[model samples]
Every structure is written in C-alpha cells, then in structure tokens.
Target: MNAPANQIPLQSATVGSDDEIDLFELIAVVWNGRRVLLGLMVTAVTLAAIYVGLTPKLYNASADIYPVNTIQLALISPGFSADAENRATGELSPELLFNTALMKLHSENMAEQFLSTTGAQVNPQGANPQTAKQFLDALSVSKEKSGTRAAINLHGTQPQETATQLKAYLNFVSQAVIVSVSRDLLAALDASIQYIDRSMEQARQQAENKRLDKAAVLAEAADIAAALSIQEPRIDHLAHTEVTPFNDKLYLLGTRALQAELAALQSRKQKDAFIPELRQLEAAKSALLMDAEKVRQHQTSIDAFTLPASILAPTQPAAPKTALILIAAVVIGLIAGLVTVFVRQGIRAYKIRTQSAYMAGYKKEILRREGHYAVL
Candidate 1:
C-alpha cells in the first residue's frame, strides 16, 4: 500500500532532521562528558611532560668567524709576485675566500685532519668514524647578513665538550689556510731567490766586461806614450843644435798636444766612471734579497693569518625547549580532549537511535499480530 503524500513528506523531513547536526547539541554533548574530556586533557599533558623531562638535553656552542683579508698580504708581498698564470686565476675576493673557508670547515677531510692533530682516537682500530659522524652532526656553518662573517655552531651533550670541539674545528681551519699560504709563499721565495741570483750574476758579468775594456784601452795608450817618448830625444837634440828647424819644432809641439789629448781621453774612461753605476745595480740586488728575506719571515710568522674569535661556554641547551614543549603539549592536549569528548558523544547518540528503532519495530509487529487475530 502507498503511504499518504503528507506522511511521506513528513517522513522525508524527519530523515533530513536526523542528517543535520546542531552546534548547540555538540556543545551539550561535550559538556555532559566534561569529566572524561578533562581526564584525557590531564593524561595527555602528563605524558608530554614526562617525555620532555626524561629526554636528554643538548648544549649549543656558537662562534662568529671573521675571515681575515689575507689576500691583501699576498698582493703586497715583494717576493711573491703574481705572474701571468696567477693573474689568470683572477682576484681572490673576500667573498670567495670566505666561502672556501666555510666549505673546508664543514668538509670530512678537515674532520679527519682534526682527529689526527688532536690525537682523539675513538675506536680500537684507531678509526674515528663515529666521532667524525658526531662532529658532523653537531657542526653548522651559516653566513651572516653583514656578509663579512660566518657563524659556526655545534651541539653536544656536554657544554665543555661542545665548546672545545668548536675551538678545535676553528683552529684546524685556520691552520690549514695558513699552511697553504705559507707553502705558496715559500715556493715563491725560492723562485725569487733564483731570479735574484741570475740578475746579480748578469750585473757582475757586465762589470767585469767594463773592467776588461778599460784595461785594453789603457794598454793601447801606454804603447802610444812609449813611442812618443822615443821621438822626444831626437826632437830635443835637434832643438839644441844649429839644425833646429821650424818643421821639427812644429812636429814636437804637435806630438806633445796629441799626448795631452790622449791623457784626457784615458782619464775619462777610468774605473771610477763605472763604479757608481755598478754600485747602484749591486744596491738594487741587495734590496731585492732583503725583501725576499722579509717574505720568508712573514711566512714563518703566524701573524699573517688572523684566527677567529675563541669559542666560549654554551649559554643554553639546543634541545628540550621548555617553553615550546609546554606550549605544544597544552595545545595538543586541548585538541585531543575535545575530540575524545565529541567521539564519545557520537557513539552514545548512535546507540540510542538504534535502540529506539528496534523498539518501534517490535511494537509495530505486535500490533499487526493483534489486528490479524481479532479479524480472524
């Protein structure tokens, strides 16, 4: 049989009402189960607190590394000159050097070098893989906004250990850079020494050649003077006798004049003439050698490379952030508790609706059975 149109519409409306849930009803359900919600909130908070309290605390050690402009020193060094090959490499800007240092600071090679330098043996086999891993885990390198410096940070369970590790890492990086620069400087110094040797040798050779030329000129002048003296006797006797002639006297005077001119020319070409120029060249060579020595001193001295600031004790723990943990726990607890309350209320409502339906079906069946018996 077909249900009445009005009844069908009313039934449809009832089903729609069941599907629509009200905000007030949800609030009422939560309120009715306020005890359970509170219990769940308290339980969640307690668990979070326990976990936070039991977790190990980590220490953070931080330091600011200011890369010194050592490239300027290289540019100014007299012994170490940039050749065409070096110029082809381009200028070493502060930014590039900083990035290079930063990369080396975080490199595994540095970690291994550090381990060897510090004698920190971790395993029985003398392999420090674990320590290396720990060091890498703790290490962090980042650039600052000012662009002149970088920040180094490390984390460890102990404050002293963290600080010490950071200091060692910085020392390793600084020493590595200094060693590299020193090697280059030393190599340049050796080259400069060789160049100076060649230059001095050449100067000495030229001076010797000048001396030989002066000696040959003096020998030739001496020969010419000896011949003039031999003729002098003949010219003097003729002047003393009645054969004293005008051509003879003229020849004598002319010969004397030639000797005087020769003497003047010889005087001009004396050793003294080349002494000043040769001395100047020697002085220049000496100065070059001195500058090379100065470069060697600079390389030997550790003052060329400036190390970063020393590492200090960590001011705070890196992990187990108390305020953040507590805040997070509170938020999670509140949410979980509210969700639990709503879920419990929804389950109870479902069970009540199911029981009412069952009861209504049973009642309808009984009524239909009674109607059938009465009709019979």
Candidate 2:
C-alpha cells in the first residue's frame, strides 16, 4: 500500500463517494508506476529463477513398486469380460490411495530417513524459516494421471542423492503399503505346518519305541512262563524226597490234602476274574498303541494342510517424478503471485481511505497533554 517509489496516485477519493475500483484507472496508475511494478515482478521472478537454479537441482530417483495383489494384471489376456471376480480383483478402485499417500506424508521416520539421506543439515550458521519452507515443501507425494499409481517426489540439495534416497525409501514404503488378508493367514498356516511337522516326527519316533518295548515285554513274559512250568516238576520231586517209611502213610494223607487244595486254587486261577489282570495289561498296551496312532494321524492331517499363495519379494521402491514437481511448482507460484497482487491492492485501498495518519499527530499531542486536553 505504501506505493513503491514514484508510483502515482492516479485517483484520489473524495470523502462522499463509494469505494468503486475502475480497472482502466487502476491500469493507468500501475502504468504510471510501471517501473516499480515491473521491477518488483522482475525481482521476484529473477529471485525465483535464481532459487530454482542455484538453490538445488535435485533430480528425483524413484523406485517403481507395484502392489503384489495387483501383480496379477501381468497376465496375457485377463478377462475383458464383466465377471465379478475379474471386476473385484482387477479394478479395485483406489480405496485407500488418499490415506496411503497421507500416511506416507505424515510418516516421521520416512521423512527423517529422507532428511538424513539428503544430508539435511539445519544450517548451523543460521536458521532461515523461508529456506525451510521451500525445502520441506519440495518433498511431496502426488497422484499421477493414471489414477492407480502415486508419484512420490522429493527436492533437495543434491540431485542423484535425493533421487536415489527418495526412491529407495518410497519404493520400500509403496511395496510395504499392502492390503493383504491372505498374507497374515499364510504366515499362520506356515507356522502351523512347521509345528505339525515337528510333532509328526516325534509321534513316529514314539510309536516305533513303543512297538519295540511291546515286543520285548511279550518275549520276556513267554520266557518266565516256561521257567515256571519247569519249576512245577521240581516241586513234586522235592515233596517225594522229603518223605520216609514211618511218615509215608502220613505223608500220603498230607500230600493228598495238599494236592486237593492246590487243585482248588488252580481251578480258581482259571476263572475270568483271575485272567482279568493280564487282560488289563493287554488293554493298556492296546490303548497306548491307539493313542500313538491318533498322534500320527493328527500329524498326517497337519502335513496335508497347505497355504494357497506364497508371498513374493518386492522389486523397486516408488519413484520421484519431475513432471509432477514442476507442475506443482508452477501452480504454487501462480497462486502466490495472485495472492500477492490482491493483497497489495487491498493494502493500497486501505491506506488511501485511511484518515488515521492525519489524526495521528493530533492524537499524540493530545496524549502528551493527557491532563490538559479536554474532550471536544
């Protein structure tokens, strides 16, 4: 509003009129002050050019990473037909692109990684707010014409380094930006498969060991039964050897009685009740065998369980795009220029209608004589 040197005030307002702006008159005023206006514009544009040239010529190095889910589009003749599966899988509208871009923008670690790679020194000698704004503003992620893909671009001091670092980080993040229910499911299934394999091996070993022990126990029991049969004949011989003539009749009666009692005891041993102890042992062994089989069967089931899809390693990161950056710079500069013009014009009008400056001297004088000045 303080018209820069030699800018003429083409039209002065009389106190009675509406503040209407005439474009032609305004042009004339500006023409009168064309040197100043042109000088300011030239200065601004020259500075902008200088900044665009000297401040940094950062070339963006970008990583191009496609979503793994979207990788299926590489097919030769993916159905051009309107099938639901095709529709669902193929053109999954960029539902989360905005959120994804925003998340990347707000990502502090990502930003810091970029900052570090670009050798973002804080200018220890001096901290300039305007410089910070320009550099910070340069790091931008924007959507390309292809609605599907996003372009992550960075501006910095060095071209190759900024390009390289930005692409590396952005590419990783882009690939990292995953929308996968299958991935989590696959991981869980893989873990389960591993655990089942370990369990299967253990079950097999245990079943083998139990089978061997059963065979050995059966063999030992047979040997013991044979020894008991041999001992039975010796019991009869010893009873006869211990007898004499005087006690022979007594011995016969005692032997007959003992034999009768032995017969009764042996008859009782032949009953189901007595045999049940051996049956129970056999039942226990059978039960153990059944348990071992079940464990093996469970292991087999685990071995059969398989994951549907495997995760593939990501290729390159998202890339820096020069076209996008230049576009944004042009837009921002124009906006800034427009804003500057309107604001300057408003300020000029405000000052033109300003009566405060004239009254300012009187107000100060009155203030200086606060006790003496009477209100009029």
Candidate 3:
C-alpha cells in the first residue's frame, strides 16, 4: 500500500549523485551561470578602469648624494690629538656618515626644516605638522653598498615639486650635519681653553709660592749671618771657609749651617720650578685657539656638496602604469567571474534539491490514499 520502500532511498541516491560534481558537472555549472559570470567580470573591469582613470598621476624625482668624509667636512683643531683624530675618523667613516644622512632624510625634523626653507611644489602654501609628516612619507632613501654615495627619491603630483622637494631634503640634511658638528667643536674648544686657563693659573700660583719661600729663606740666612758677625756679601765663600784658630767656634758653625740651608733652598726651588710646563701649556692654548678659528672659517665655507652627474631628473608621469593597471584589472575580473560561477551553481543546485524532495513527498501521499481506498 505504501510507496515502494526503495523509492525514498533511490531518490536520496539520486540527490547524492547530483551532489557528487565532476569535471563535466562543473563545466555544466559554469555554462548555466555564464550570464552571471559575464556580469561580474564586466562590473569589476569597469570599476577598476574608472578608478584608474580618476587617480592622479604621480611624478618621481631622485637625487644622488656622494657623502664626503665627515672628517673632511670638519676641520681638526690645532690641539686635536692623534687619539681624537682616530676616534673622529671612525665615527665619520663613509658608511656611517652615509647611513646617518639617509636616516635624517626620513626624520620629521628634517622634513619640517625642508618645508620651512624652500618652496615645495606639493605644499606651496606652507605646510603644517601633518603635511610635514606626509612629506616624509613620500620620501625614499637608498645607499650604495660599496661606496659613500646615497640616493634620495621623492614622489609628488608635480614634476617640478618632486624635484624641488628632493633637492631641499638633501640640502637640509647636509646643513644640519655640518651645523651640529661645528657646534660640538666650538663647545669642546671652549672647554679645552677653560681647562688650560685653570692649569696655567695653578702653575703660576705654585711658582709664585716657591719664589716667596726662597725669599724668606734668604732673609732668615741674612739675619743668622748678621748675628754671627759674617758679612752679607761674604756668605758665598762660607762653603770654602778656612778654619782659623782666632775665629770664634760659634761663628764658624753658624756660617756652615747657613751655607747648608742656602744650598737646600736652591735645590728645592729648582725641583718645584713649573716654568717649562707653563710654557708648554701656553703654546697648546694658542694652538687650540688657532684651530677654533679654522673651524669657524670652515663653517662659513660650507657649500653645496658635489653630487654625481647621474642624478635622475623627475619623470613627468611615473605612476599608474597603464599596462600594470590593466593586468591587475584582468586578474581581479577573473577572480570575480570564478566566484560568480560557483555561487550561481550552488543556488541552482539548492533549488533542484528542494523541488525533488517536494515531488517525492507528493508521490508518497498519493500512494497512501490509493492504498486506503483499496481497503475500503
């Protein structure tokens, strides 16, 4: 009386077969959903083309920087020691200096300085902090691996603006470094001069004290010689005095004692002499002052660094490459089309499943009613 027990199982088996899609089924799915796939591809391509057309073209300007040895840039002061020169040389190596300059190109401070100093084509109205950050964002720096040369590249909407910004950025970094080093040297020179002054003052005071002590010793000897009945002018001969029988024993003893005291004082004075040291210090101070002057002169002589002739001029239209954009659009269109095909196939498959289940139930109801009629 009921529908064949196998009917439901057979229908389920058919549904399972439909779900087990193979290459032919996949091809059918795509063919059935061809319209949808076409629509998606057209839409994606159209949107991409519109966006590309609306986007402004960008220009790129690049400048080559040949980093001069930082040591050459800085004038060594007269009193700069060999050790100091070695230290400076290490810090100013071509590689180190190039990296330092490269980093400065990206710094916010350098960006702001560049903006303030020159007429930037992108932000001709003068830039605020936000615009300055944008300026830094638009910059790129690269250094040569084997040489002291570096490169600065900048992007902007205008070719002239791009070039100007690149030049300004390079100038700002060079000036900043020179100014910083010059300031440091000036400070060091001042410190050295102060130290020298202090040393000279101490030496002068010590030498003056020794002379005063010597004078006091001489005065004491004079008084002792007077008490012993020895003449002031005749004290030099006291060391060679001939013992006489008529001479008072006390007088002879006092003369010998005075001679010993005078010798001791002369020796002490010679030992404490700081004159040679003072002269050397004075000469060093003069040399340092000369070096400081030279440094100042060098600061004044700073000119634009010579760069390689290989500097790249700004390209008029550097971005939104047509071929590249078209290629990207094609890739995106293909992806959208594939997605559309699968989605359409899934919807169609779901509807077929619903219709098949509905028919199966209807057939089962009809068969049940016929079985009841036969029983009646």
**Candidate maximizing TM-score:** 3
**Candidates, ranked, lDDT:** 3, 1, 2
Q: What pairs collide in candidate 3?
A: none
Stretches of candidate 2 exceeding 4 Å from the true structure: 1-54, 68-201, 212-376
Ranked candidates, highest TM-score first = 3, 1, 2
How would you encode candidate 3's per-residue C-alpha lDDT over 33-149 as one tens digit per residue?
Answer: 788777877887788788879887777887777756555655543345312122221122444445666677778877777667764525521333337777777777777886667
Which whole-number lDDT from 0 to 100 does residue 294 have in model 3? Answer: 82
Name the weakest run of 10 consecutive residues (lDDT summed) in model 3.
82-91
lDDT of 2 at 335: 54
Which consecutive 10 residues in model 2 have the weakest lDDT in total? 299-308
Q: Which regions of candidate 3 fall more than 4 Å away from where they truly are?
A: 1-22, 63-67, 77-79, 82-103, 119-121, 124-130, 141-151, 227-229, 232-274, 300-310, 316-325, 349-376
lDDT per residue for candidate 1 within 252-284, as digits (tens), equals 333454455446555664443554545544554
